[model samples]
Target chain A: MCELDREIRRWRRQEMRRSSLSPRELDELEDHLRARVELELELDARLTPARAFAIARDGLGETSVLSREFARAGAVRWRRALGYGWALFALSFLLPALRFEFTHEPVQVLSLTGYEVFWAAVTEGGFRHALCNLAMLLTLPALWRGRVRGGRWLAGGIGLMGLYLLATGLSLPRGGGGFSASLQVGYLVWAASFVCAAVGLWLRAREWVPTTAERPEA
Target chain B: MKKPVYKELVAASSRPMVLSILAGGESYGYEILKQVKVLSGGELEWSDGMLYPVLHRLERDGLIAGRWELTDEGRRRKYYRLTARGKRQLARDRVSWRAVHGALEMSWGGGHV
Candidate 1:
């Protein structure tokens, strides 16, 4: 009986693993399986052949290929992705706005100085730096949407690049005394991109394919 | 004893029998098979391997729960038990079964008489 029980546990674990059940879900399933085994033992003690056959008939009704808990997990993953995307978008908008608000006067002064001087200052900031930041901002939505053919790799790469850009931006000299119009425009663009990314991610992650028809009950 | 009817009997008896067993207490794979054999007087036997699928389904439906535990002898065991919902469902099932049985008897017997 113990050997059989071990085998059953092994089998159930394999099934749960295949279903990608998380730690909590696997724990719950293990508990349920254990309870089932105990009940079977008790019934084995009491039942006669015909009655057992009848009981087995009832027990086996409507078998499913996947556990309900695991089935719901896919939806949960999509929701998490959507949430993360929205959070990043919110942060993207908030951080830049905060920076602008704190140094509004300097930003207005910088804005009045015309594009040539502004461009020169930013150029001193380096093309690679600006390009990197721009790329990071642009890639935010792509990462958030995360459904392109190479989405996972792309998102990972973009995330790394974004981190690098952020680190570089922080390390760069804060030469311009305050927020410039160019900086404001850059901030707005980044915020807009983040919002778009959030929306895109939400759309992509949403289980919009009408799962009702696919539901077992349906 | 014919193949098709034998198959039908096997199919129909699987779930209710398992549910009934769990209604008593928790059970595992081999023991469930053994109990079924005993209950049916060996007339309605099931392949030992096929029981897991049914068990999995029942667990999925939230009618039963399963867990693993170790015995004093250092042996691990998986057990299953009925939830409150399952018990209520069993009662409803009993009522429905009785109704169906009664209706069948009334219709079939009235004609014979």
Candidate 2:
């Protein structure tokens, strides 16, 4: 292909990083750009493809601005995606709890489902454990809004909590070896919630990374 | 030579103009833009980059729809046309535009025509 086509392809590749714009949207945009160049050429035969491409590109708009718009649009969409994932996971946690909701004072998940481990967390775990889950829940909105700084906060929060759990779980069992296995399992189960929060934060963090065009603003 | 229209004026009117053009039939960016220049005799000078955002904003607002089609020559093109909602919006816009046009014309003492 010509330089103009090659440049258009290159721009599309860069724009793909935005993730908000679908492949079809990018294809449509490229077609629109190509059409603009063709319009320039039709008006003046002597115009070089590069010159025509430049004019067309200028008229079509900068890739960065367009990408920002797309990114903004994408962020709105990602909220829903993050929301669905959170909802499903939350449901997995809440579903078993539903039947068990009012019936049990301190709930026990009898099923061997991997997710019962999550339910056991909220009901059987201590106040501090529930507080960690609460922190994880609250940080989600900030991350859903696509704030990278919040991701930083989330990483620090979850990492410290995870470390704390390991320290305490190992040390608290010094009363005897009797409490070791069950306590370790409980710690793992509760920490899984923290892990879920971290994973959610990580997904949004990808969206938070500044594009080459946006980094200068920082 | 004609005076260039104010940027804000172009920004203000471009949406109605674009929506009205789409009401005529399905057309792509390049064609709609060229038509605007030809129809206005170059008075409505808009930045090249601004139109897409306007179109996108309109699309996002659900006033229009876009699709891609391959031409007889085997080239793919993106085309936009009005929606029913767009048509309803256009009718309302037409009334508003005419009111503004009448007011301006009356101010200029051309109301009798």
Per-model TM-score versus the true fold: 0.39, 0.58
C-alpha lDDT values of all predictions: 0.51, 0.63
TM value for model 1 = 0.39
Summing lDDT over every window of 10 consecutive residues in candidate 1 chain B, give the lowest-scoring window.
Answer: B69-78
TM-score of the first chain alone, every candidate: 0.34, 0.40
Scored against the true structure, residue B32 in model 1 reaches a CA lDDT of 82
lDDT of 2 by residue, A1-218 (tens): 38887788777677655334445556657777788888789999999888887787677666667655654533344454445435544554433321212224453433223245444556776456456666667666543334434566775677577557655643332323222123434345445545555655666666455332111111
Candidate 2: stretches off by over 4 Å: A17-21, A70-218, B110-113
* lDDT measured at residue B14 in model 1 versus the true structure, 0 to 100: 76
Q: What is the lDDT of residue A17 in candidate 1?
A: 41
lDDT of 2 at A184: 30
Q: lDDT tens digits, residues B7-69, model 2?
A: 888888988999988988999877888878887888998666566767777776789887666
